[model samples]
Target: MLTQLTISNFAIVKQLELDWRNGMTTITGETGAGKSIAIDALGLCLGDRAVTNVVRPNTKKADLSATFDIKKNKPANTWLSQHDLEGDDECILRRVISSEGRSKAYINGSPVPLTQLKELGRLLINIHGQHDHQLIVKASEQRRLLDNYAKHQNLIDDVSYYAKKWAELTNELERLQTSQAQREAEQQLLQYQVKELDEFSICEGEFETLENDYKKFSNSQSILEDTLTTLELACDNEQFNILDSLRQCVDRLIQYSDIDGDLANVSTIYQDALIQLEDASNDLRHFHERLELDPQQFQVIEERYSNAINLARKHQVSPESLHIKHQELLQALANISGDDSRQEQIFVELDKTKIDYLEAAKRLSDSRSKAAGEISQLITSSIQELNMPHGQFKAHVSTKEGEQLSSHGLDDITFLVSINPGQALEAMHKVASGGELSRISLAMQVILADKVTSPALIFDEVDVGISGPTASMVGDKLKQLAKTTQVICVTHLPQVACKGHQQYFVAKLTDGEHTETTVTELSEQARVKEIARLLAGDKISEHSLANASELLAS
Candidate 1:
């Protein structure tokens, strides 16, 4: 429910604030008095396009805001919570347009994108302007309305889900079939590569170890000669052997040890040196005995090292990464082989999904067919009461042949009507005049009032081209709709204004230099005079006043 609306410097509305209540609230004024300014302001707050010209001539910007009570509106409350914009029990939507043509939107005082504001606005209010009558001409809009009336939202969702799944599977199968021959040739190449890699069976760190062994085998003779030379210098040579000289020096130092403490220290040092030289000679002799050159082992080590380097280059990878590359190739091969099997499985699933989609669509179509009859009867009865006594209304639901599955199912729905006895029923847009279309729209809304979840409905000029008894009937229908939800109507008919539980009068005020539009909530006497003015065209006579009173009384 819209609880309040505020407009500042918007068009001719200098500053205005109006409090609203549930039930029918009628707005009336003379022509050019800006009766529709309130509706326009509401549109601005509901994310309508803003223009600089809408700002008051002397003002730099226009501010518009609307407050909605959503404590009982589950869909609106859910939307607020989902978008992280939930406030107390009320939601405030605000929009501001600067003279430079820039605009900003806010929800609950927090800035939001324009699209978010529009989405939430749709859930909170339904404004049925005179132009909305043209929407009946669209086939898609017709489908939407029929589905909404039938409450087939869940079925519609299922059809959408399955349709998307079917498209995905079909595309995958097509792609696989297109590349079947190329994949077969690639599979043979992968097999040969796998076999060759398995033959080498390379282990981590094997390349480095092979290179080390090859180095040792190729330099065996040089290693043996070097070790033997080192041994002769340390202890193996017969002349001037280091170990023998050190032993003789130690014996000479021991003879003087009793006479001199320094000589005893020197003898200990020489003895330690002789022992180290003897150990070094023994190690060299052992190394020389082990250094035997084997040509066959050398040849094997060289061949393995060369093979590793060449293969690493061939695969465009370092020797250390060869193992990882092998695993990657194996995975690629497995995926290519798996595609054929996966394609067959997808075909099976695609068939099942198509069946599911068709079954769901059929159920929806049946429900629509049943609902068409009931809706047509209800609307036909409603329009007759609105003064179209000879009118015939039908909800035409027909199956679309050879149509691919879609989110809206397979039914093409259109509303057909005829306002005379001899005329055949034709599409509502082609057959109904502007006035008849308004009445027809009103009838449909009256029948579907309970089904609509929007908390507020605004009817702008729905009584256009309608007057006399038919105008009164339109007023009564709007009043009936207000019983379940808030109804705000901008009307020029005295009968409709008299039917309102509350009445507001819009008028233009001028201060010589400027003109501004103002709204006044009418008291009993004020409402009577306004209604009289509507009836008498700016000259309220005694008869008009009395008529207004009687209309209000009724």
Candidate 2:
């Protein structure tokens, strides 16, 4: 339920605040008295597009806000919690439009996007303007209204889910089929590359080891000669061998050790040097014996190294990266094979999805067919009471063969009407006048009000082109609707205004330089006088006042 609306700096309304209650509230005013200004301001708070001209003459911006009590509105409360903008029992939607055409929206004091504001507003209120009757002519809108009345949302959701799945799988299958030839051509090249790489069997770090071995084999002769020369110098050479010289130095130092203890340390060092030189000679002999100068082994090592370098160049990678490239090629070949298997699986899934969509669509169609007949009968009976004595309404539900799966199912619905007896029924847009259309729209609204989730309904000038007993009937229907939901109507008809539990009067006030609109809640006596003015137009005679009194009394 909408609790309050506040407007500031809006066109013709400098500042206004309205507190609303849950009942039938009627707004009455003369021609050009800004009766609809409040409705327009409320629309702004409900995320309607704002224009710069809506701002007051000298104001920089226009501000509007609507407060809704959502304690009993589960959909609205869930929406607020989902968006992280929940309020304490009250949700306030605020909008600001600047003179420069910039705008901002907020929910519960937290900034939000306009789309989210619009989404939340839909759950809060339903506004039907005089122009909304034009929507009766649109086929899509007709289907929507029927579905809403039917309350088959669960079946519709199933159809939508399956249809979406079907589309996805179909698209994937088409893509795979289109690329089949290209994938097959690439498969041959990938297979050849994988085979070649597998035969190479490159190991990590083996390339560097192989290169080192090749260098050692190539330098074997020089290495062997160098080791023999070092051995001769250390011990094998008979003249001036290193070990013999070290032993003579050790003998002299040992003799001096009897005179001084420091000489004993020096003798120990020379003896250790002799032992180290002998060990070095032994190692040199071992190395010389192990060294091989085989030309055949060297050629084999050279060829292997060359082949590795050539393969690296051919693959456009370093010798170290050969193994990584090989693995990648193998994976690519595996994916191509996997795609063939996946294509078959997708085909199977698509067939299943199509079946599911058809089943759901069939269920939805059946439910809609049943609901359409019931709603059409109810609306036909309702319009007759609204002064259309011979009015007839029908919800024509037909099926289109070979139609593709859609979110709304495969039913084509159109509303047909006949306004005269013995006349054939034609499309509503072709047969009904504007006034008749308004009545039909009203009848439909009355029939669907209980099924609707919106807590509040606003009718703007819905009584246009209606008066006398018909106006009273319209008023009675609105009042009846208010029994289940809050209804606010802007009307000029005294019959309609008199039926409201609460009445408000709108008038324009001017202060020489500026014009503004003001609204005032009418007292009982004031209400009678206003109705009298509405009856007599600017002059309230005694008879008009008496008539107004009688109208109120009834």
Candidate 3:
């Protein structure tokens, strides 16, 4: 759930910090008091498009951030882990918009693209604007919502896979029907390339081995001569070798230890040195015996290494990558061989893939057809309770049997509604009243609440055109939704504002030159006064306070 929000220089809000709690909370104040500031700030953190106007006057930039607790949000934590961004149970998303309209986003303090921020935001918070009903008119949007409600992602994925396969095979079939001469020419070229690489036969990891061996062999003479010279000086010399000199010094030191006190310490050092020199000479003699360098091997290695380099240059690749290129050419050659037979084989495969796509699409269509009716009835029941007792709703799933296949399936889903008893059901956009659309949108959201997996839900003036018991119905719906997740609403209606588990008052403060908007969480006594004000226009009389108190009790 959303845990905290901090805004700096955003719109009229110079600085604000809000600590959010679970369940439904309402924000209410006089008109133009910046009641929507919290929603706007959260949208920016969620990667909403930003412009210079969002920055407060005389401010260089607008900064916004939101924190979410994701310990129980598996999808969010999984996404973070997949992207190497996982941390503690808390996830903080931040955004900074400069006055020049340039913006930057960060997740967990690491700079990220807006696309990533938006993707993560979808899993944390969902903000519903007053005009979201306008988006419900798009058929694509309708389809997405219905699909989410249907919860048959596996069926959808299967249809998509088969549709994609069908497309690939169709394109291949068209290619196979093209000119035969071009195909033959392409085959001949691939054959020649494959033959060249085949003869070279540079196995994996061989390029590095070849280089190492070449370096070792080319310097064999110097390595052997130097080793022999060092061996003779260190141990082979009878009169002046290092081991013999160290031993003589050790014997002299032991003999003079009693004569000088400092010489006693020097005797121990000489003895240790004698031991170390003896061990070093023995190891050197062992290494000298194992050293062997072929006199004629250098020329063979030099030629092979040169040829490898030339092959790499001809192929336009590094010598170390030549083995990978060889494998790629080999696979291409295999794919290009026997074009005529392959074309015939593709014709059969294409038919099978087309059949598979249609079958899977049919299955998905059936699942949607079943889910659509259940959702339609659920929404109808909701709208009837939202002051449209006689309203009718239906999700029409029109499946095209012989039409072109789509990645989503063969169904065209549309939402039809009628807000009056004698009215004919029609498309939502064709209706006249914005208030009716708002109610329908709310009804749909209420029915499909489970589909919105985000931990927090925010409604900005969603009850704009509602009043009386209808506003109370809307509040009931929001509070009911809050049973599963946190709900925050900004509203003017006392009926809705009074239904919150907690309430906040949005107020604008000004002296002369500067103006700022602030949000304060209201106490019990304060809530009564505020609700009374909402009920009776800036006045809190005794009767209004009594009514407010009674409403709170209920």
Candidate 4:
């Protein structure tokens, strides 16, 4: 159950700390007094969207936090343990919204995504909004309510899981089954490509070797000329050649070798350089002798290289990578041929998944049918208590065994109602008036209270448009609801305000420059005044106070 709420700089609230208790707590204020602001703050902490301007004016950020004692909330505690967010006995959910419109959520003290906060919040509290009845028109909402009443989420989940598996299997089968013509065409094209690469039979690294040899033979004349010129400069020159100059320097240095130590080192360096130059000149002459210009060989090698280049270009592969691409094409052809066997396997999977989905969906349908009968009777009795004595309510779960499977299983649930004694049962949206719908929505909540998992339930003006005895009945139901769980109700009716275990009064205060909302837990006398203020005008009177006291006493 929720134990504490702290709100700061949120909307018109400057700062507020509220402690909650286990039982029905009524929050009453005049219209537009911001009675729902605390609820809004709680919603934000529960991971509701943080819209722009949510922060108090001139404030950089808004902070909201809620503390829950999960000692009795096993589901919430289990979730915490699963996420490794467990504490001694408390869980804190917090939301911070910057003035720049960025928001962050935290579990305990660790940051989390908004989705995780919302998921955990669902287990901690259930908020029944004022306009929840408006959603009765939606078929999905109707189905969800019935499922909630059924308390068979495992069945629903199984159905969903099986349905997803079915979809996946069917999709795979279709991918392999559809486009048969295209698949065959692709196979044929791959076969032709493989044949062409096989016939070409270009060996690995063959293209580079062929290209190098062709270039060497084509440029053989220039190669020989350059070789001859280098040899002439180094050793073949008739006079003033580099080799001769080095030889003279060696002899000259040897003469002064004993005269100076540095001169002796120079003599050794000159001698080594001369020997190296002679060796290089001999190697160059040998290379010139071995070189041969074979135009015919060059022409043959050039033709082979050009074909290799053309083949690589045709296949869109580098000449060096052509072999790799050939192997890839071969693998592709093998995979294409194996598709028939793979397709057969997928067909078998589809059949198995279809059977699984049908079984799960059938179980869900049975559960829904049983839950529908049970909840319908409860809702009908509760609606009569809310001043609809002649009203007849039915939760009809129609199962389509012959139709296709859906995520929600084979059931289509409809909330049927007959507001008049002899009227035929019909959908709530088409039959119930706004007042009737509100009462019905309330009755559903009252009946489904114990069926829910949340330990705390908040009702935000769900009794709007209801007054007098109906409002009194609404309050009685809420008070009864608190016997099993904590209930927080924001209401305007004095009848409802008088039925609280604790009462808080909301009011707007302003001095012309700044406006703010404040909530005060009322004392016995203050409670009476606030209830009286709700009954009559803002001006309290003896008669109204007496009436308020009478209501509270009852």
Clashes of each: 0, 0, 0, 0
Tens-digit per-residue lDDT, 1-554, candidate 4: 98999999999999999999989999998888899999999999898999869999999999999999988888888999999998879999999999999999999999999999999999999999999989976889988888888888999889898788877777777888896778899999999999998998788788889878878987899999999999989988997689999998998889999999999998999999999999999999999999988778778888888888898999998988888888999999999898899989887887787789889888888888888889888989999999999999998888776435578888778889999889999988998989889999998887777787569999999998899899999999999999989999999899898999999999899999999999999999899899899898788899999999998889
Give the Å shift of residue 457 in candidate 4: 1.9
Model 1 lDDT on a 0 to 1 scale: 0.88
Per-residue lDDT over 1-554 for candidate 1, one digit per residue giving the tens place of the 0 to 100 score:
99999999999998999999999999998789899999999998998988879999978999999999999989888998998989999999999999988999999999999998889999899888867667766788777777777887888888788888888888899989999999999999988887788888777788878878988988888898888888777777898777778888888888998888988888888888888878878888988998888889889889988888888898899987887878888898999999989898998998898899889888888999988988899889989998999999999999863436676777889899999999999998888998888888778766766675668999987788788999999999899889889999999999899999999999899989989999999999999899888888778899999999988988
Question: Any idea how many clashes model 4 has?
Answer: 0
Highest-TM-score candidate? 4
Q: Is candidate 2 or candidate 3 better by lDDT?
A: 2
Q: lDDT of all predictions, in order shown?
A: 0.88, 0.90, 0.87, 0.90
Instruction: Give the TM-scores of the predictions, in the order they appear.
Output: 0.76, 0.78, 0.72, 0.81
State which candidate, 1 or 2, has the greater TM-score: 2
Winner on lDDT (1 vs 2): 2
For candidate 2, which ten residues in a row score worst on lDDT? 399-408
Regions more than 4 Å wrong, model 2: 192-331, 511-513
lDDT of 3 by residue, 314-363 (tens): 98999999999989988877776766788898889878877898899889
Error of 3 at 42 (Å): 1.0
Tell me which residue pairs clash in candidate 1. Answer: none
Those runs of model 3 whose alpha carbons end farther than 4 Å from true positions after fitting are 178-337, 451-453, 539-546
lDDT sort, best first:
4, 2, 1, 3
